[model samples]
Target chain A: MNEKVAKLYQERLNRYMTALDCGKPDKVPVSFGIGDWIVKHTENNFQEIFYDWEKSIKAVDDILPEFDVDVFGGGPTLWWPPMWDAIGSKLYKFPGMGLDENSTFQFVEEEYMKAEDYDAFIANPTEWIATTYLPRISTEFENPSSLRGISALIRSSVAFAEYNNYMGASWGKWTVEHGVVGQFTGMTKAPFDTLGDALRSMKGILLDLRRRPEKVAAACEVIVPHNINYALSGAGADTRFPCFAPLHRGSYPFLNPYQWENYYWPSFKAVIEGLWAKGKRTYFYAEGDWTPYLEKIAELPDKSIVFDIDLTDAKKAKEILGGRFCLIGGMPTTLLTYGTPEKVKEQVKRSIDELAGDGGFILGAGGVVMGDAKKENIMAMLEAAREYGTY
Target chain B: MSEKEKKFVPEPGTCTPWKVKMEELGGIPGNEEIVKKDWERLDETAYNFLWFWVHR
Candidate 1:
């Protein structure tokens, strides 16, 4: 790294963490919420990068230099199609393997785990995961996941290690080289979200919650430690990159307080606390409307967590989270796709007024850049922040 | 190039649903108009709501 480039990276990193410390830096920090939009922006389709890591980096390089975002959220971490195809990922569809060559990789949700399997799941998760879950989810993993004997275990273990080495090395190179402070260490999910998203479809989980609450709760317990362990051990030791735990199913319009409190909050909070004990902080992309749960959110360690909120009014979130947490986003994606440059500025001004008030705010869209977002508006989104957001 | 295709989330949550040709997923028959209107309606609601939030 050039001396100046490294210094610039550290300066940008410091500016971001300072806001997280609830201090006003020289200016407001803005982080990019990238997606396949960059692929389309660079005159390519999703299939190009979905198939190759180098292409994904090219897509990042094509557009990232245009804007100076304080944090790079590892723009487009493409999955290893071979690994998912082997494991029988219940939630993914990639190019040519399942969809057309030019098609964007998609997530397919199905109820893979049945109610009766709760016993099998709670019995020996590691064994059950290798034998039952793997094969049931992916066609190729059947023979490997059987673990009928030691040879089978060795085959699957070696296969998994190779897959891990491939995906981990590529993703790490992109995140470390591109990420300023560090890349988000790894992704985490609320154990219930994991259960809902993968094992059970959203509908399946909702019904299970109503029909067999205890089984689902018990299943969630078995998965919590795994989430914590992965977050802590999945990446480099003592890295500044906080593992991101995106709360999707727990967001508003999806759960009642009774359901959220009993099922989601405790386990998710435990995982955060678990990482916290290891000196790890978490960056939560509380997707969708989380205004209803801001009070519950305020209970976590002050300044140790950064909350990137969506849909919730920032002024109200700040009031509830006053000095108890740092806030990252409030600019809605709507403003970027349809609003004019002036409109984008106005929203940035409002975010400054609301979230950037006590110096805990970093201005950004609540979610990823819309794959169809207007180029002019995206530029405006950044420009407005720099102009009005200077502290 | 269909107007219905113009606005359907076709996939999960992003705006460029057409980025993937969703022919395999097929269409929800009654949703054509609902999507067209909502596409315009939601965009308008969001922009209008934001326009007011900033000015207010």
Candidate 2:
């Protein structure tokens, strides 16, 4: 960690903390994240690098030095090799879906749950964990070859974190000694969402809601707390802030708004409240038109962070949630990909000027940076934040 | 149909018996109607999620 880089990082973190309170910072902080598949694709290979801990760290290090985002975070989904090992699923590369690391048990296998199985799923979840889940990782230990692969994955995550901190020293000034890296864990979804994943096949989950509402609710109740526990445990109970992304791909255009609220909101509320009570704040990434759920979300007990919303207007979001909570993202990934740098900058400035009025605002691409998003546009977003995010 | 009743279509591709039941006593759309409504209410949650990403 370079002394100068450390100072820059510390100053940036301070500014960010202040700005989150709706106060001006010395300058705005910027962060960027790229998925592993994207990195593998860009590098044109996946073999050992994906499993190489040092290379993983370098991959992030290479990006942060130039991009200079305040926080250095990674997805727990990517980190938990043990969990993947337990599942015994192979990571299949899908052209557009990113990486498809299929789960070991066919969670949605036909006739596995003939009402009686549902009874068993609800009565003792550990049974499900033991039968359907734990085998994925436990098997790796038994198989030496598989164990080696698992070991590499674990080592790589450790290395990734180590390098993240080493590199973070450059960003953190002396007072803030290391990179502020946060990882997502225990991401509980709406009861319906959990039910959708657990009891029903993707299609079954969707259809079950219309056909077997009670069963879905029962399954959700049984599973949602488990997810909440996992998320909190992964994030750490005292975590001041944790990030969560619930990819509502099918739920969005497919489900009607009314059905969404009744089935999903309670589980979401329960999870948010559970985390909040434990003194952890959440940074929820609203993947789709959460526009339908904004009013209910406003009722949260504490308004600590922002929502990284996609396909929604930040200005409108600010109007609805500005006084209560901070606002983070809104720039469209597609716009960033296709638009000119100036156009990107203009959007950033508008977002900042309009939403950053009383403070409590940050800027980012509306969604994750896929492989296709132009690197230049990402830089443009950073520049615009720096230029306009000043006090 | 009444506004609340209108909200009670069977879940997307299935019959009415398959939907998740809303525990919230009826205001409109029974429990099903409120799922979307409750999601919309999360503007603050959304705001905070983005705010942290940008600022942190």
lDDT top scorer: 1
Candidate 1: residue pairs that collide? A88-A138
Worst 10 residues of 2 chain A by lDDT: A103-112
lDDT of 1 by residue, A1-391 (tens): 5576567677778878788777888888887756665666665566766666667767765666566778766656445564454445445778776788666677777777787888887765554554576566655455652454334334434444565566566555544554444436765678888778777779999998899999889988877776776565554455466787767788888988999999988888888887878778788888788888888988887766788878876777889985777788867888777788888888888878777866878887886665667777778878888888887
Q: Each model's C-alpha lDDT? A: 0.68, 0.52
Q: Which candidate is the best by DockQ?
A: 2
Using all chains and alpha carbons, the TM-scores for the candidates as numbered come to: 0.79, 0.69
Q: Which residues of candidate 2, in runs, are more than 4 Å off?
A: A1-6, A19-24, A36-44, A47-49, A73-87, A90-116, A133-186, A249-251, B1-56
Error of 1 at A152 (Å): 12
lDDT of 2 by residue, A320-363 (tens): 77767766775777877688899999988877777677766666
Q: How many clashes does each candidate structure show, in the order listed?
A: 1, 66
Query: Looking at model 1 chain A, which ten-residue stretch has the lowest summed lDDT?
Result: A145-154
TM-score (0 to 1) for chain A, all models?
0.90, 0.77
- lDDT of model 1, residue A43: 55
Error of 2 at A258 (Å): 3.2
